[model samples]
Structure formats: C-alpha cells, structure tokens
Target chain A: MTERVRVKTMMPPGHVRTPAYLRGKVGVIERELGGFSNPEQLAYGLPAEERPLYRVRFTMEEVWGAAAETPTDTVDAEIFGHWLERL
Target chain B: MPHDHPSHSHEGMSPSGHPYRADNDTALTYWQRMEIAVRELLVEKGAVTPEEVARQIDTMDARSPANGAAVVARAWVDPDFKARLLQDASAASREMGFDIGPLRLIAVENTESVHNLIVCTLCSCYPRNLLGLPPDWYKTRAYRSRAVIEPRAVLREFGVELPDHVQVRVHDSTADMRYVVLPARPAGTEGLDEAELAALVTRDSMIGTGLPRTP
Candidate 1:
C-alpha cells in the first residue's frame, strides 16, 4: 500500500525545510529519498540529526481546492520525516 | 598634482555580447562589503587561498545549460541511457562527464500525456550544477508563488499551452533534491544526430517552463 501522510501545520519561527503552503496538507509518499541532515538544526549551527526524506505527491485539488488550475494535476515536494505524520 | 589613473570604460558589450557586470566600478553594496570582509577573514585564518576561491568561481562559471542539453540529447538517442537518467540523474550526469558535485538530481520525464514543471517556492533552489544559475524570472516572487498554484497559466506565459488531456506535475524543490525535466524529443527529427538534438534543447525546456524547439 502507498504510504499516506499529512504535513504538520506547526508554524514555528525558524529555518524550516517544509514550505508554509504545504503545512497541514495531506499527501501520499511518492518515493523515499533516503536520509538527510535536519536543516532546522543545521541552520542554528547545531549538530543536526539525520532524518529520512520522502517526496510527497499532492493533487492540485488538495493543494489549491477551488482555485486549482487543473483539479487533477499534482504537486510534488521533498519533505523530511518529522514533518510528516502517517495517516 | 592631478593624477589620471587608467580610465575603465563600460560603454559597449563584452566579447560574449553580454554587458559587463557593473559591480566592479559601482559602489560596494552591503552584501558585497560583507563578502569581502568574510573572504579576507577566511584567508587570514588560513581557511582558503584566493586562488582556490577563483578556481571555484571558474568551475561554477563553466557549468551551463549546454551540459544539460548534452544529457538530454544523449537520452533522446539512447534508451538505456534514458532509463538510467530517469533512475538516477546525478550518476547519469556524471557518466556523461559533467561534474555535478553533491547535487542530488531527479530527472522528470515529459511524455505525451504528462508534463513536469520545477520551482523553488521557499527560495531559488535549482539544478544549478546542470543548468547553471536560475534565470532572474525563476527567482521572482510571481513565478515562485504561482508556478505551483496556477501552473497551466504559468506555462501559457512561457508559450506552452497544454491540452486538458495532459496532466501537469509541479516539483517544488523545498528540500535536498533538485529536478530537471527531460523533455520529449520533437517529431520529424529522425535524421538529426545527438549534436543537432542538443542544439535544439533550451534551458527552459529542461526546467519545464517551455517546450523543446520543434525542427
């Protein structure tokens, strides 16, 4: 089964890899892109922990709703593990 | 006594036909001053030599859309290479002798029914190792915000009007990965070799903002 996930809507003020537009949006894992250092920690010059990253695919309807240019079109983004919650 | 230093002129375009960068004679911006200070500090601390910095700049300057064009052209002619390119773009680029240096690349294919567009909504992260620097428009607020939201309209602005039957996929470089679109080869070019095909591949086509030239 394809892994389904929801992006956390946390709006913490810092250097975050997750974009504001994707927060709270639900999407499916397109592919696992292996592990990468957490940018949030790296931005503060701290020792960053490695996190698994996945490419998440969201339909235009899910991302833009009624304002979608093409309701069935898709958007893909690389989101770290911590930001994604299994759904 | 009045001293006349050699007057540096900026009247015409350079030999490359592009206007010379005005930063040399212009007042140093705050960021430029900061860069100078940081470079001097780094040199003083024995972190890096001026020659190393110059060499790195030259390396970056040598990378351009032509590198990406060659990759696309080879993919168009060789099915095995195309498969490998789609599987792992970074390795495929290196196989073709382009030094991409730590850039994790993803090659998105454009088929008859699917089109791919790339954007960096958060910032201007691009496949710079393959396509040189992102165009000024790619970094603009309009392109970044609208590319994902209204990609069809954005494509139209770039002179690409896709039919409703074709699905559009927008790749936002929000993290570590970078994407390059492998545009479909135009029809009626069977006689053309790899070099001719490469000549027809434009930077925008690889970025998915525009289509490859029809010839």
Candidate 2:
C-alpha cells in the first residue's frame, strides 16, 4: 500500500515530470496508479527504470501557502514514488 | 465588409492583362506539414499502414465533449453506473461504447463538499477519447502554471464560484493517465431527463472550468 508523503525539494537538471511548484509539498496518497517507465530517463533515450506512480492529494493550502484563495481546497497530481518522502 | 457580391470571382483580368489569382485558402502550417510528411513517410516505409493512420484520425475526429456529457448524464440518473464509472473510467466509457484507446482514464466526482477540477501541468494530457481535443487555453503555459498554483482563483476566473466551505480538488494529469471531472449535477436539474441533462452539461463543465448551465 502506498503511503501519504511529501515531495522532496530537489532541483535535478533533466526532463522531469513533477512540477516546480509542487516540490517540498505535503500530500496524501489518493491511490497507487501502477508502475511505468521513468519518463526522465526515457527523454534521454536511456534504459527506462520502472517506477511506481501515485495520485497524491494536497490541500490547496499546502501548495500555495498564503496565496491560496480557498484554504480548504485540495489538489491532486500523479507523481512517481521517487519524488516522494514519507511524512 | 460587403463580400456578398453576386460576381465575386478571382478569374478576372488585371490592368496588366494578367489573370488575377486567389489566395491559397488551404494553407498548412510548418508543424502540420511536418506531421503529414512524417506520417506519410512512416506509411511508405511500412512502419505504419495508411489505413491504420486514417482510422486513428477518424477515431479522433469522431470524439467530442458530447460523449463526456452523455456519460455524466447517465451517471446522474443511474447510481450503479455512477459507482462503476468512478471505480473504473476506461471500462465504464467502453460500456457506453466510447473507445478510450490504451490510456488509463480516471473519473473524479464532485460532491457537496468536494469539487473536482482537471488540469495537465506537464502537457495537455486529457481524456480526449471522451472529451475530444483539449481547448487552446488548456495548453497555455499560464494555465499549466497557475492552475496548480492558485486553483481557486483560476476557477473563479472561469466563473466557477465554490462556497468557502466547499473543498476544491484539482487533478493534475502528468503521466500516461488521463482525467475527467464528473461535475456535480445542478440542483434545478432534478426534473430533467437524461438527454435534457446531457444538454445541460457543457464542455467547460466537464473540464471543471465552468459549471452546467442553470435551467
């Protein structure tokens, strides 16, 4: 079972699927969306390493901080497992 | 402004006694030309069949937001179907005869407390199998960045106003998976039948960029 986690604030230099604004953000695992070939490696035509993908749910507050118009709102993103760290 | 002339033809003689030519109406963009060239080359090289390419194009052309509207309308009336749809979108779409291709499709429901919004931050990844092509704005960099940054404000710009207590959930499709929002049925739509309800569902509503028109 995948667990809720926070995205690591790492700025790796390459083709990445995770958005910049979502780094270091806390979100709960809505569901595991199965594994797929890592897109980062695929972009470079390298051997693709399969990685688990999850639909992560974040409170609007977690992403936008004070700028969030609706503090109670939530957002979900499909992210690979490697970007997430256990909260 | 008056282009309704009875004798509007380009086959006229110019002052220099030369035939006047009309502008090229069927102009292809650089990218479009490149795409056609690549597709044709692939077919010629036996990498892909021309018929297969034509079928794929036809399938894409056959799809529209109306397919999504029909699904949402069915879900509003049938509880069992709604549960199945929320559980497995691709299968549910297929049940209603929608060809979802090979991509994984997920349907997020909007309830009394939670409202669902769909966006593709990386690219314009969407359930095109049902909702047809992504709109021009959906592919904009501003939308991609702002939708995730300030979803509520963005929703407001689209004229979707949720109550303070309602929690808006924005789904950012980033991978092979595609998402479609199953928008909440408007309150006054209780007396409407399935077809009428479907008519009420707009393309923007399915994208969570707008609400169903109030009856």
Candidate 3:
C-alpha cells in the first residue's frame, strides 16, 4: 500500500521548508529522496540532523477544494519526514 | 591618453549585444556594501583568495539555458538517455559533461496528457547549475503564491492554454530537490539533428512556462 501522510499544521514562526498552504493537507508519498540536512536547524546556525525527504503528491481538489481549476490535477512538494504524519 | 568624459562603446551595449547595467557607476547599495565587507573579511582571514572568487564567478557566468537545452535535445533524440534522465537527472546531466555540482535534479516529462510546472514557494530554489539564474519574475511573490493555487491561469498568462484533459502537475521546490520540465518534441521535427533540436528548446520551455518552438 502507498504510504499516506498529512502535513503538520503547526504555525511556529521560523525558517521552515514546508509551505503554509500545504499545512493540514493529506497526500501520498510519491518518492523518497535520500536524507538531507534539516534546513530548520541550519537556518539558526545550529548542528543540523539528517532527515529523510519525500515528495508528496496531493490532488488539486485536496489542496484547493472547489476553487481548484482542475480538481484531478496534482501538486507535488518535497517535505521532510518531521513535517509529515503517516496516515 | 586620458579622456575627460566616459567613452561610449557599442552604444551602451556589451559585445554580446545585451545592454550593460550601470552597476559599478551607481552608488553602492546596502547589500553591495555588505557583500564587499564580507568578501574583504574572507580574503583577510585567508578563507578564500580574490582569484578564486573571480574563477567561481566565471564558472557561474558560463552556465546558461543553452546547457539545459543540449540535455533536453539529447533526451528527445535518445530513448535510453531519456529513461536515464527521468530516473536520475543529475547523473545523466553529468554524463553530458555539465558541471551541475551537487544539485539534485528531477526531470519531469511533458506528454500528451501531463504537463509539469516548477515553483519554489519558500524561496527561489532552481536548477541554476544547469539552467543558469532564475528569472526575476520567478522570484516575485505573485508567481510563488499563485503557481500552486492557479497553475492553469498562470500558464494562460504565459500564452499556454492547455486542454481540459491535460493534467497540470505543479512541483513546489520546497526542499532539497530541483525540477526541470522536459517539453514534448514538436511535430515535423524528426528530420532535425541534435543541434537543430536544441535550438528549439527555450528557457521557458524547460521551466514549463512555454512550449518548445516548432520547427
């Protein structure tokens, strides 16, 4: 089964890679890119830990609802493992 | 001989025919001053030499959309290369002798039914190693916010009106990876050679904003 995940909805103010529009949205993992240094920690000049990154694909309807120009169309974003909650 | 006033050459255009910006003549901005200070500090600290900085700038200037166009043209002509590109874009580009450094690239194909668009919502994370610098419009807040929400409208603004059946997949370059769209080969160009095919590839075509020129 394809792994489903939801983007975390936390709105803390800081350097974050996850976009605000994707917060609270659900999507399936499109692919798993290898581990990369976490930018959130790097932004503060802190020692950053490596985090797994995954490209998550969400339907336009899921992201924008009725406002979506084409509901079946999709949006893909690279999200860090920390920001994703497996569903 | 010393001139009293500045000499006019090429009617204010560079040898490449592009208008030269009066960057040096203008008063240094805050950011420019900061850059100079930091560069001087780095040189003083022996972190890097001025020659090294100049060489790095030359390397960056040498990279342009033409490099990407060559890659796309090769992919269009060779199915094996195209498969490899779709599987591992960075490796494939390196095979073609492009110095992409450590850029993680993903080549998304534009087919009869699917089209791909790239945007960096957090910042302008682009395939700069392959395609040179990102355009000014790409960094605008308007393009960043609207790309994911209303991609079709944005495509229309770029003179691309897709049919209803075509799927628009917008890739938000939010994290480590960068994306480039592999535009479909135009019809009636089967007779063209690799260089000719490459000529048809435009910067916007690779960015998914426009289609390749028809031969």
- Highest TM-score: give the candidate number: 1
* Chain A of candidate 3 compared with the true chain A, TM-score: 0.96
Query: Which 10 successive residues of model 3 chain B have the least lDDT summed?
Result: B1-10
Give Cα distance to truth, residue B36, candidate 1, Å.
Answer: 2.2
Q: Against the hidden reference, what TM-scores do the models get? A: 0.90, 0.84, 0.90
lDDT of 3 by residue, B1-215 (tens): 33223455556666665577766677889999999999999999999999999999899889999999999999999999999999999999999999999999999999999999999988899999999999999999999988988999999999999999999999999988999999999999989999999999999999999999998
User: Once superposed on the true structure, which residue ranges of model 2 sit more than 4 Å away at CA?
Assistant: A44-46, B1-37
Which one is best on DockQ? 1
Q: State the local distance difference test value for candidate 1.
A: 0.94
List model 2 lDDT by residue over A5-73, tens digit each. Answer: 999899999999998888999989999888899999999999999999998988878887898767777
Tens-place lDDT per residue, model 2, B99-199, is 77885889888888887788998888888888888899999999988887777788889988888777778889977688888888999888999999999
Place model 2 in a CAPRI quality band: medium
Would you list the rank order by lDDT, best first? 1, 3, 2
Model 2 per-residue lDDT at B129: 80
Predictions in order: lDDT: 0.94, 0.86, 0.94
DockQ for all candidate structures vs. native: 0.87, 0.71, 0.84
| DockQ result, candidate 2 | 0.71
Query: Between prediction 2 and prediction 3, which has the larger TM-score?
Result: 3
